[model samples]
Target: MSPINFTHILTQAVDELSESESYKGLFHQHTDGNPLPSAHALCNIVELARAIIFPGYFGNSTVNSRTVTYHIGVNVERLFDLLADQIWAGLCFGGDGECNACNEYQREEAAQLAANFISRLPQLRRVLATDVEAAYNGDPAAHSFGEVISCYPAIRAISNYRIAHELLLLGVPLIPRIITEMAHSETGIDIHPGAQIGSYFTIDHGTGVVIGETCIIGNNVKLYQGVTLGAKSFPLDADGKPIKGIPRHPILEDDVIVYSNATILGRITVGRGATVGGNIWVTENVPAGARVVQRR
Candidate 1:
C-alpha cells in the first residue's frame, strides 16, 4: 500500500477553506490592531456584574455591611473596565467592514456606552432583587432568599439576562447577545436580551423556557418550565426574507401566570391577572382574569 500524502491533503483543505466564496457572508475579518469579542472576557463581565448585584451570594462571600461598599466599588470598577473593552470589540464587530476610522470612533462610543450601562447597575440590581423575591415567595420549596440566590438556576439566568438587557438598551451590540447566549448554554433557559421583561419576573424550574426578541412581559409574571413566548409567524419581505424588527411576540400584562409547557405566540396580549394552564397553545388575546387550560 502507498503511504498517504498528508501534507498535500492539508494544503488542499486549507485552500478550500480560505476561498472567499466558501466563507461568504459568514466570516468576520479582523482588522489590524482591532480586537474581536471574547467569550471568556464576556463571561468574566457577567460574573463581575452578578457579584456586584448580589454581593455576598456571588464573589467575595465575606462581604458584610462594613466591607460591602468597598467590595461593590471594586467590582464595579473592574466590571466597567472589562465591559468597556468588550463593548469596544462588539462595536468593531458591527461596524462597516475593513474601515479603520470607524473602528476608532466605535472605541470611544463603546466607552461611553459602558459607562451608561454602569450607571444603570443600581436599577438593575433593584429589579433583580424583585426577581429573587418573586422566585422565593412563589416557590414553597425555597427556604430563604439566600437559597434562591445561591442555588437557583433561574436567578443565574435572569441575572445574566438583566445585565445583557441593560447592555442592549445602552446600544452595545453583539456583546449583549453573547452574554445571554452564555446563560442559555449553561441553563436551558433561552432568553433574548432584546425582550422587555419588567420587575418581579420569576421562572420556576426554568429549563426549556424561550422568550423571544420582541416579547414584552410585565411585572409579577411567573412562568413554569417549558414555557415559550414566541412569534407565531414572520412577516416576510418582497424577497421572501422575514422582515426584521417587527413586534411579533406576545405581551403579558401585570400579574399574569403561565403554567408549565404553555406556548404563547404572536403579538397578542394576555391581559392582567390571566392564567394560562400547562401544555396549551394560545395564539389569541386572553381577557383579564381569564383562565385558559387544555380542553380535556
Candidate 2:
C-alpha cells in the first residue's frame, strides 16, 4: 500500500476508535426514534389501494371490469407484502429485541390478521363506494363520481380512516396512528384508528373534527366541521401520571348528525337521528330524535 493511503486509513481508524467522531449531531431532543418502516410508505400503499379500487375515478384511465379485477389483484398482492413487513416493524418498534416468547406468536397472529384484512378490501371498497356516491349526490356542484373521488376531503379522510382502522384491528402497532395522523395533517379531520365507525358514515366540510379512541359510532352517522367527540380529563393516577387507555370518548347512535363547533365530551351518547346544532357544548346524553341547539 502507498504510505499516504496507509496514513489515511490509520487516521480514520484512530478517529473512530478514539470516539473523536462524535455522533451526537445524528439525533436531536424530542425524538426517541424507533426506526422502522415509515408511516409515509404505508400511506402510499393506502393511496395505491384507493386508486386500484376506484380505478379511473382516482387514476386517469378507462377502467372496465377486466382492468378493475387485474388492478385489484395486483394491489392485493402488493398490499399483503407491504402489510407483513410494516407489521413486523411495528412489532419491533415498541417491543424490542424479539420482545418476548409471545411476541413471535403474536407476530404470526398479527400477520394472519393483516392478511385477513386485505381479504376484506372488496367489502371495504363497497362501503367506500357508497361514500363516494353520497358525496357526489349530496353536493349539487359535484360533476361526477370521479370529481368526488379526486377532490373531496371527505373521501380522502374516510379512506385514511378505513386503512388505519384495519391495521389497528390487526394488532399492527404504531403505524395505524401514523397513518391516521397523515390524513389529519392533510385534511384537518382527526379520526383515531381505534374508533369504531360504521358504514354510510359522512363528514361534511370535515375540518377540525376530532373523533377520539374508544368511540363507537353507529351506522349512517354524520359529523360536521369543528365537532369534537372528545374525552373529559379526570384526576391523575396515584403516581400522578396520566392514564394511557380508558373508555372515555362519546358514542353516537345511528343516524346522528353532530354539527359544527360542537364539543361532546365523556361517555355520553347522542342517540338515533338526533341533530346536534352548531356551537353546542354537550356533556350529557341526548335521547333519540333529540335536537340540541345552542341557546341564544
Candidate 3:
C-alpha cells in the first residue's frame, strides 16, 4: 500500500482554517491584556457561591454555628478575588473597540461590581431559602431541604440563574450568560439571566423548562418540566432584523402554576393564581385565577 501523506493534508486544513473570511465574526480577537472569561473559573465561582449561600451543603461539610461565620468569611474573600478577575476578563472581552486596552479603570469597575455582587449574596440566600421551602413543600417526593439542595436539578439550575441574574444586574457582560449556560448544559433547564423571577419560585421535574429572556415571573410561581415561556413571533425592525430588547416573553403573575410541556408565548400575561395545563399553546393573555388546558 502507498504511504499516506498526513502532514500535507493537515497543513492544507490549517491554511483553510486560518483564512480571515472563514473566521470573520466567528473568532474573538483577544487583544486585551486580561484573559477571556474562563468557564472553569466561573464554575469555581458558582461553587463558592453555593457554599456561601447554603452552608454545610457545599464546600466544607463540617460548617456549624461556631464556624459558619469563619467559613463564609474565607469563602467570601476568595470569591471576591476570583469574581473580580473574571468580571475584568468579561469587561475586556466585551468592551468597545476604542477601549481595547485592559486599563486600570476596567479593573476598578470589575472589583466594584464584584463587591456589589458579594453584598447581594445575603439577599440571594434569603430568596433561595424561599425556593427551597417551596420545592420541599410542593413536591411530595422531596423529604427534606437537604435532599432538595443536594439532589435536585432545580436547585442547581435556579441557583445559577440567581447568580447570573445578579451579575447581569451589575452590568458584567458575557460571564453571566456563561454561568447560566453551564447550569443549562448540566441540567436540562434553561433560564436567561435577564428573566425577572421573584421569590418562592420552584420547578418540579425541571428538565426541559425554558424561560426566555425578558420573561417576568412573579412570586410563588411553580413550573413543571418542559414548559416554555417564549416569543411567539419576532417583531422585525427597519433593517429586517428581529427587534432587540422589547418585551417578547409572557408575564407570569404570582401563584401561577404551569404544567409540563405548556408553551406560553408573546407579550401576553398569565394572571395571578392561574394554572396552565400540560401540552397547551397559549399566545393570548389569560385572566387572573383562570385555568388553561388543551382541548379534550
Top of the candidates by lDDT: 3
The root-mean-square deviation over C-alpha atoms between each candidate and the true structure, in angstroms, is 1.6, 6.9, 1.6
State the local distance difference test value for candidate 1. Answer: 0.91
**Residue range 77-175, candidate 3, lDDT tens digits:** 999999999998888884433335688999999999999999999999999999999999999988999999999999999999999999999888889
1 against 3, candidate with superior TM-score: 3
lDDT of 3 at 58: 98
TM-score of each: 0.95, 0.81, 0.96
Please give, for residues 1-296, the per-residue lDDT of candidate 2 as tens digits. 64445878899888886673464444322223333666666876777678767776654377677677777677677777777767766665543333323346656765786688887788888988877876676668889987888888888988989888977876777888888888899999999999998888878888999999989999888888999999987557999987777889999999898889999999899999999999989999999999999777
Q: Per-residue error at 244 for model 1, in Å?
A: 0.5
Task: List, residue by residue over 93-159, the lDDT tens digit for candidate 1.
Answer: 7444442334567878888898899899889989999999999999999999999999999998999
1 or 3, greater by lDDT = 3
Please report, in order, the local distance difference test score of every candidate based on alpha carbons. 0.91, 0.80, 0.94
Q: What's each prediction's clash count?
A: 0, 0, 0
Model 3 TM: 0.96
Which 10-residue window in model 1 sums to the lowest lDDT?
94-103
Best candidate according to TM-score: 3
